[model samples]
Target: MLRRRGRLPAAPWLVAVTLSALLLAAARPAVGAAAWCIARSGASEKALQSALDYACGPAGGADCAPIQASGLCYLPNTLAAHASYAFNSIFQRSRAAPGACDFAGTATVTLTDPSQLWIMHLPFISKHCRAIRNTRLSILHSELHV
Candidate 1:
């Protein structure tokens, strides 16, 4: 006689997926994992726009390709949003220097991962975002200066 096997129930699978997502959401940054960027609040629109131009252009020395129109970070287009991306790129590339994120008093550093808010919606770029954050954190821990 042959025996038949039953398939697992969908409820359990759903529960497991939910739990996994929660765990990932709660994941903490590695020790000394901090990053800096321009703050979207408290700055005048004109100042933010000027800073964005400088950051994406020459002064800040960051690649603003991703924040350009038709780019992954271009959605919900706003001066502050685009500026934040550009400022973060400069901050990460400049090794989080003391003033790299300042943008003339418009920026600040935070322990929380900015990518969590910025790139979370981009499934294709999520992994790349984590990689960039992780690399920056690791570099931050190793490099005593800045």
Candidate 2:
């Protein structure tokens, strides 16, 4: 009997295995960008920071206290006016999967110079609710590939 030759001779399995790995390796983000988040909220960057701390995690201790009548609960007193219009780069929690960053809860934002920048001014409230609609704050995600 003559030697048999299959229509597909070489192994297609090897080709598939190689491609999957290359795709996954390239999918990860840079070490630096992956380390932390660059958040922009309120006018001063500090306000957003305080908000992150208030999340009540051990990682950032000072932020773990009960909201105080003194303005510690939300943006501080000095920053109130500008708070509605400011978005400063703050916290960093991976937004893709197991890690994520989001507004503490339902927030309300009002646009100050709605005409100029069209950027809204965020407001402080005791509680966050879904019915609330804010112009300044929003949920956004960048689909940039690694």
Candidate 3:
């Protein structure tokens, strides 16, 4: 007769997998929630300024705390900068709903995360790229040999 192996308890493993999934979901940005600012090339300067004013004012319904003096996002202190913050705040708070990012043609919604652009522009991005390339090469080499 063949010997049978005993089974281990599954509760702990199930809990661990559930926790990992929740953490991963929390770490990622909300789907379709990415925000775009009006301060881009070819946008009308006057319209952008007006949109910023409204976004920061009570009419726009955005929390302007971060853009205030001495606030975390207060630096740069330009109209476009402040407006971008306000517009993004509103867009996120609204759960990225349809028309949430449309600031009277001053702004548009984008699927790409805006923070990724900042990260790419950082001085250390090249180092990160090299590391990723090296990792990919290692994986490819191993796969080919296998």
For model 1, how does the per-residue alpha-carbon lDDT over 32-80 read when each residue is reduced to its tens digit?
5676565557888888888878888876677877666656556547676
In order, what lDDT does every prediction score? 0.67, 0.34, 0.63
**Candidate 3 residue 58 C-alpha distance from true site, Å:** 1.6
* TM-score of candidate 3 against the unseen true structure: 0.52
Point out the worst 10-residue segment of candidate 3 by lDDT.
119-128
- Per-residue C-alpha lDDT of model 3 across residues 1-146, encoded as one tens digit per residue: 44346643577668988999999998765765544543443557798878877877788887777567755456556665666667777777777767777777777655554546663221112244346547877999999999
Whichever of 1 and 2 has more lDDT, that candidate is: 1
* Lowest summed lDDT window (length 10), candidate 1: 118-127
Across 1-146, the per-residue lDDT of candidate 2 in tens digits comes to 34357534346657777899889866665444432222333434565545454443354332222233332234333343222212211232223232333434212322222223222222232222112323112422223332
The candidate that achieves the highest TM-score relative to the unseen native structure? 1
Regions of model 2 farther than 4 Å from truth: 1-10, 29-34, 40-59, 62-146
Badly placed stretches (over 4 Å) of model 1 are 1-31, 117-146
Error of 2 at 109 (Å): 24
Candidate 3: regions farther than 4 A off = 1-40, 119-146
Ranking by lDDT: 1, 3, 2
Model 3 residue 42 lDDT? Answer: 50
Every model's TM-score: 0.57, 0.27, 0.52
